[model samples]
Target chain A: MNLEILGYSFIQKGLIAGTAIAIICSLMGMFLVLRRYSLFGDALSHMAFGGISLGLFTGIYPLWTAFIVSVLGALGITKLRKSTKISGDAAIAVLLVSGLGIGVLLISATGGFKVDLFSFLFGSILLISTEDMLLILGISSGIIATLVALRKQLLHLTFDEEQAQVSGINTDKLNYVFVVLASITVITSMRLVGILLISALIVLPNITAIMFGKGFKKTIALSVSMSVISVVSGIILSYYLDLAPSGTIVMISVAMLVGTLLFKYVNVLGKSHVIQKLTSEA
Target chain B: MNVLEVSDVSIKYNGHLAVDKINFNVKEGDLLGIVGPNGAGKTTLFKAIIGLQNHSGKIKLFGYDEADYQPLLPLIGYVSQKVSFEPNFPATVSEVVSMGLIPEKKLRKGAVLLKNCGYSWNLLYKKVGKDSDKVLECLKTAGLESLKDRRIGDLSGGELQRVFIAKALVKDPVLLILDEPVTGVDADAQNKFYTVLRKINTENKITIVWSSHDLEAISKLANRVACMNRKLFFHGEKEEFFSNKELLKTYAESAMQMHMHDHN
Candidate 1:
């Protein structure tokens, strides 16, 4: 091993951002995915794509636009679901298409898809500036800390909204808080997988951790650990293999999910074999 | 004070009346068992009272505003008709019960990023175990102390039902609302469940509005009876509600019609 990549400033920044994002994504994504709202994150990221497009078109800081657009779009889903007869997933679909549509139109309006927008579409982990990474770090810390404080309420609402509400928890407020955190998570994850694959950060790690069938807190801990490892390993491998960081990160996370499922299958197989042998002997 | 006051409350589904002009009230310390057949709007009525379902008219809980249930939440604990969730979601029995004790007022705090900075972590994770005496006592009441550490998904339906009851009971609310809470429970457990309910109603004076299909349980346990078939068919003393053969016959026929309509 050359061990030379560790000295690079970009690699250090990527590592810091990757680890922070992994923790926040796993924490918030667990709640969203479990509630069947994982796709809501995907849709919000699309909305962020539109924001990024608008920023690139207007010559403004795209992160600010992405933050504003995605947060507003995320809240729109909640409001639409609450105020109308439409389902949450249906509301998400409306935003997803509208975001993607507006994004393409904006790119065309700005004289077609520019190279600047593609970096955000596919992520540019190696190209992170000090300013960008600092903002990401600040927002990521805020999201993680907020998640920690609202931990039990999130789980309570996730488990049973009616029970939580009757217990005197204002569930709608917790829901808004959850969506805002999820939106911010999508916004900061731009440098990791950009707009297209951002939900992977939230969903893949959680599915992998859920395979272990651990209890609630343990399941979250396992997800964060898995996500951090995948990100760290992906970045290191991308450096040595000359691969795309965003693609590499998502591929590694999916590979972990497969690996966990395989492990559980083999464990079940081994237990069954032992039982078969015992019955034969009897 | 009346623990719950429902006046001229009506609920509609797709422009058809589900609960029409239902009027009733429960004084503090009263244990009211509401019994009605399928599609009789018992569940709908409960949902309206809790502000879950949209309805017309007024529902005043603990002297709070009509229809708005936020302030009354701290004083109320409820078990909905559908008491379940994502099976694989990681929640333990004790943790589920401890959720009830998370002060309703504390939970109503702002959800802004830095607004809940003073939120206590210990109140959530540390106390969410067998360590909390209230959780243990509630679990004990439900005969589920041994299952406190088990994953809720790993439990039987009956056990899961008790876990929810423990969650509802852990807070010791002024008003306890349960809708068919003992559906999957065995007879012995059901007997014990009612016994605990009776004790709480008499000793703690926790006003209860329990809806059930089991007329036997309601007849034995309820001091007040309410029979519904899309409307308030009867709301008075249990003896008056049960002894009136003409009223019972009318409700029975309406229930049969509703049951047949459901099948159709």
Candidate 2:
């Protein structure tokens, strides 16, 4: 491994921004996965594509438009699920298809900004400007602060929403707040892992950590560690291999999940073997 | 003295009235059982009293009006019917119980939550922590001290119920509300659950308002019973509720309707 590869300015930027996005997305993902909204992340990211296209067509900053559209999309999904007969997954499906269609139409309408569209669709982490790094840091800190301040209330609502409401939690307001935060989280993370693989960052680490049966705090800690390892290592490896950074990161996350499952299986088999040996000796 | 005063409370869901003009008063330390068929508004009445749903009319707890009930929520613990969570929620018995103390500590004591949840205070000297002794006491009272570190999902239905009871008791609530807590529990587990609730009510002197469809259990355990089918049918002593043939018939009819709906 060439240690000097880390000396590149783009590499440094990618590492810093990617690390920040990884931490927040992993934390946010734990709740999303637990609440069974794993696919919502994917849906929102796709919707963010449409937002990006709209931004391009209107000659505005794409990320800012994405931030708005994704938040609105998240809130819309929540409201639709609650108000109509549409289930959560169904709502996500509707949004996912519509988002892609709109993205395609806007891209064509804008005379095909292929280079810009490609950069957004698949993340161009190497092209992350200093301002993007600052934005990522600011958003990550805000998300972290909000989660810390409302940790207990969020836990109550996550574990038992009805009981939380009964305990005087403003559940309706909290739901909106949470979804908006999550939407912002999804949008910010797209720069590091791209629209396609953003949900992987949001889901894979937490699900892997859950397989270990640790308590909530421990699970969260483990997930964050896993996410950091995946992001940092994937960034380094992709630099060395000259591959797509987002794909590399998502693949590493998937690998980590599979590794945990295999380890659990092995552990179970080893325990059963030990039990059998003890019985024979007796 | 009445601990819970609910008067002329009505709830409508999607423009259909679920609980209509319901009025019931539960005295301190009374074990009041609410029995009704599905969609009979027993749950709605409970929801209204606990401030989970919007309703017309008034509810007073400890003589305080509805608007002021938020501060007193820690004093009122509720367990909803068929409460389900993520199978791998990653909460231990102690951790889940600690959540009950958050509202209390946040509202009254303004103490750092790490202590209230039973983390060692030595790690953070300046942070005022929850009293570990009080948490253990609540766990002991609910017979869940032995399972404090065990994951809640690993426990049996009866054990989980006890953990929830301990969770509620951690706040030192004067009132405990349970909705069909034993509905899916095994027969032996159900009996044990009732025995635990009886202890909590009679020995600890905590007023309990539980909703169930178990007529026999209500007759055996509750001092007072309320029957309902959207509107309040009867609310009185257990003997009167059971002995009144007309009320019993109404309850039976509601149960029959529920069974028919299930079949359909």
User: For all the predictions, what are the DockQ values?
Assistant: 0.52, 0.55
Model 1: per-residue Cα lDDT over B115-197, one tens digit each: 23321211222244444777887788778899888888888766777787778776556578888888767887777778777
Candidate 2 per-residue C-alpha lDDT over B1-264 given as tens digits, one digit per residue, 9 for 90 to 100: 667898998999878999989899998779999998988888778877776689999998766687765666645778776669988998788888877764444445312322343322121111325556666777887777888888878889888887788777766566789988887788988887888888888777778999998999999889999888888889999999999998899789879989899899
- Given the true complex, what DockQ would model 2 score? 0.55
TM-score of chain A of each: 0.97, 0.96
Pull out the clashing pairs in model 2.
B115-B130, B116-B130
Q: Which sections of candidate 1 miss by over 4 Å?
A: A278-282, B53-58, B62-70, B104-131, B184-199, B202-205
Question: Residue B251: error of model 1 in Å?
Answer: 3.2
TM of chain B, each: 0.84, 0.87
